[model samples]
Target: MYTKLKDELLVEAYEHAVRSQLDGEFLQILKEELDRRGIIFDEAKKVATADNNKS
Candidate 1:
């Protein structure tokens, strides 16, 4: 349950960052932080796709 919540929050943060037009070193730092937390963008994409498919 905690893992699921973490993943959801990570996805939300990624979405917010992208929408805010973050780039360069800041974006890289964000990616690195997420990676360190075991949340890669590709995995997030897959999770999002799966969620969409369920609807």
Candidate 2:
């Protein structure tokens, strides 16, 4: 059905976006920035969560 196909495409796009963020360069930048700021990944995630919550 059309609805099923749409759902499948949406899921594929979402997975692709997630995988794209897992690239080595991106991870290296994220780690370096977090280290420079003296914040762990979990703390950075919490800050992101807070920002999203405000929205």
- Scored by lDDT, the top model is 1
Candidate 2 on 1-55: residue-level lDDT in tens? 3543333343344346557876766566555544444432243333332334457
lDDT digits (tens) for residues 1-55 of candidate 1: 3544466676677778888988767767767766665654464365343334558
After superposition, which runs of candidate 2 have C-alpha atoms over 4 Å from their true positions?
A: 1-21, 41-55
Q: Give the TM-score of candidate 2.
A: 0.35
Output the lDDT of residue 32, model 2: 55
Separately for all candidates shown, the number of backbone clashes (residues 3 or more apart, or on different chains) is: 0, 0
Could you estimate the TM-score for every candidate? 0.45, 0.35
Whole-structure CA lDDT of model 1:
0.63
Enumerate residue pairs that collide in model 1.
none
